[model samples]
Target: MSLLSPKVPALNDPVLVNEWMAVATAADISKPTRVSVLGEDLVVWRSSTGVHAFRDLCIHRGTALSLGKVSDDQLVCPYHGWHFNGEGQCTLIPAQPNMPIPTKAKAFSYPCEEKYGLIWVSLGSPAHGVPEFMEADDQAFHTIICGPYIVNAEAPRVIENFLDVSHLMWVHEGFLGVPEHSVIPEYHVHEREGKLVTDTITVFQPDPDGRGKDVNNDYVYQVLRPLTVQFTKTDDQGSDVFAIMLHTTPLAHRKTMAYAVLTRNYGFELDDKQFSDFQDKIFSQDETILLSQRPEELPLDLAAELHIKSDRLAIAYRKWLRDLGVEVGVA
Candidate 1:
C-alpha cells in the first residue's frame, strides 16, 4: 500500500511493526497474562502443547480473555462465556450451544515465542527471525533472568541509555562505575550486517554482581535492534565472559519495560537473591537519571543533540534507528 493510498490506517502486523520485545516471562502465564506492548493488549498463556498469545479481547462481547481461564485446551472469555482455541478461533459460545462459530469471530493473534526465559511478541510482520543470544541457550553458561523494569521514558531513549556506558561514572557511581575511572578510550564503531558493533572498550570496574574478583574488563557492545542492546564483558584475567541482553519494550510512547538476561560461568554457585539485588541496585540508578532527560523521545536528527568521541555508540544507535524508518511507536 502506498503512503497516499486513501490515506488509510496502517495495518498492525505484530512481527513487522517493531523489533521483538519481551512482553512477559513464561512463568508469568499460569492461566493467561495480560501484557501490553506498544498499546496493544495481549493475552499470553501456556498450554500442554506450547505457549500461545492473542489480542486479549473476546470477539463476542469485547471482554478481556485474560480475565478468564483455560479449559479443555481453549481460552474461555469471562463475558458471555465465549471460548477461543489456540489459533484465536471462537470454538464455543455458551448462549448458542449448537450454533456454528463463524470465521470472522477469530481474534487477531500475534507470532509469539519463548526464548531466554521470556515471552517475546511482535505486532508487525517480521521479515527476520528473533534476536539471538546463543549463550542463553548453551549449556555451558548459567543464566539468570533479570527485570521487567518500568522506566518512565520512551523505549528508544531507554535503549540508548543501555548503549551509553559513559554515564556509569556519574549516574551509577558507587555501584557500576566510579567518577575517578571514567576515561573511555577511543573505540571504533562499525555496523556488521545491520547491527552497530564496538569491541575496543576496556574499563576498570568492580565485580558487577559483587561475587567475582574486580579487574579491568574488556567489553563488546552491540545494538542488535532499535530497542535491543547487549554487552559482553570479560575481565582480563578470567576466562569467563558475562553476556547480558538488555531489551526495551514500548508499552506506549512514554512508557517502556526493560527486560534483561545474564549468562555467566563464574557466579553459578551464588545465591539467586544476591544476583537479583545487585541487578536491582544498578538499574535503579539508570532509571532515576533516564526519567529526567527532556523531550523524552529519541533524537533521530544528528544535530538535535551534541555528541562527543565517547558517544560514538549512542550516535551510531540513533543513526541506525533513523535508517530503519523507525518512529515512536512503530519500526
Candidate 2:
C-alpha cells in the first residue's frame, strides 16, 4: 500500500484496529468528551440508550463535533448547527430548515460499549468483544476503579509494565517488594485458548496489605487482550485475594491511556478511597519511569532487548503482539 493510500492509514493496522480499547471511564463521558484511539480522534458521549463513540469530525465543513453541545439526544455541530444522533445519523440541518438532510452528511462512527465501568471503542470491526473481568461477576469482591492514567509511552509498553513483576522490588520498594528478596523465581507462561497465562510468581512484600507485615505473595498473570492484562495476587495463607484488570488505549504512537479495575475479596471494612489512593501512588511511581524510557515505543523483536528469566511473561507478550502484526505503537 502506498503511503498516500486512504485504505491503509499509518496507524490503522487491522490487528490493532479490530481490537477493543478502553477510551474512558463511564463517569468521564457524562458529556461529549474527545478521545484519541489508534491515532484517530474520537468523541464519546452518553445517551439515554447507552454510550456512543464517533469520529470527532463533522462532515459538513470539517469542524470538530466535540466543540458542539449535545441536546435532545443529538450532537450538534458547532460550525453549521447540524444535529447528529447516537447512530451517527444527521437528523436536522438548521441552515435550511425545510431541506432534506443528505445521507452523506453523517459523522463517521465506530462500535463502542460500556463494561467494567469503562467505555470501550473499536476503530474497525472487532475480532472479539471486550475482555472479561470475572471478578465483577462475584458479589463477594469489592470493586474499585483505579485510574485513567496518561502515559507518554506506547500502549504495549504500558501493558508490558503492568505484566512485569521484577520491577516491584526496585520501583515499588517497601510497598510491593523488598531488596532482601529481590531475586525473582522462575515462572511458567503458556497460551490457553488464545490467552497467555503465567504460573504462580512468588514475591516477598514488606507490606502486602494494610496489616503491615512481610509475607510471600503469589501472583498469576493473564493477557486478556492485545492491550489488556490482568493479575491475581494472594498471600501465603491464601486468605486474601486481590486482582487488577488493566486496559490500555493507544492514543497515538507515543501516547497512551490506562484504566485499571481492582477487585478484592477482603478489605470490605476499609474505605475504598484507601485502595484507590494506594493504586494512584503506585502508578505515579510507574509514570516517572515510563516517561523516562529511552525508546518510547516497545520493541516487538525478541532480540532487540536482552531478557532475563524473570522477563518470561514480558517476552511472551512481545511475541504475541508481533505475531498479531500490531502496527500502531511498536518498532
TM-score of each: 0.92, 0.93
Window of ten residues with lowest summed lDDT in model 2: 1-10
Collision count for each candidate, in order: 9, 0
* lDDT score of residue 213 within candidate 2: 77
lDDT of candidate 1 over 92-186, digit per residue (tens) = 87888788877677766777888888999877656677798877778988888888999888888887888887887788765557788999988
Write model 2 residue lDDT over 1-331, tens digit each, in one string: 3211133334777788788888888888878999888777789987888988888888777788888888998998888899989998999999898988876877788899999888998878887789998887689888879888888888888888889999999898998997778898888899998999999999998975545678888999999888889999988999888899998887766888899899999879888888888898888989888988867888988888999999999999999988988877788
Using TM-score, give the best candidate's number: 2
**Which residue pairs come into collision in candidate 1?**
13-123, 13-124, 14-122, 14-123, 14-124, 15-124, 16-124, 16-125, 17-124
Candidate lDDT values, in order:
0.78, 0.85
Q: In angstroms, how far off is 150's CA in candidate 2?
A: 1.3
Instruction: Give per-residue lDDT, candidate 1, residue 273.
Output: 76
Cα misplacement distance, residue 127 of candidate 2 (Å): 1.3
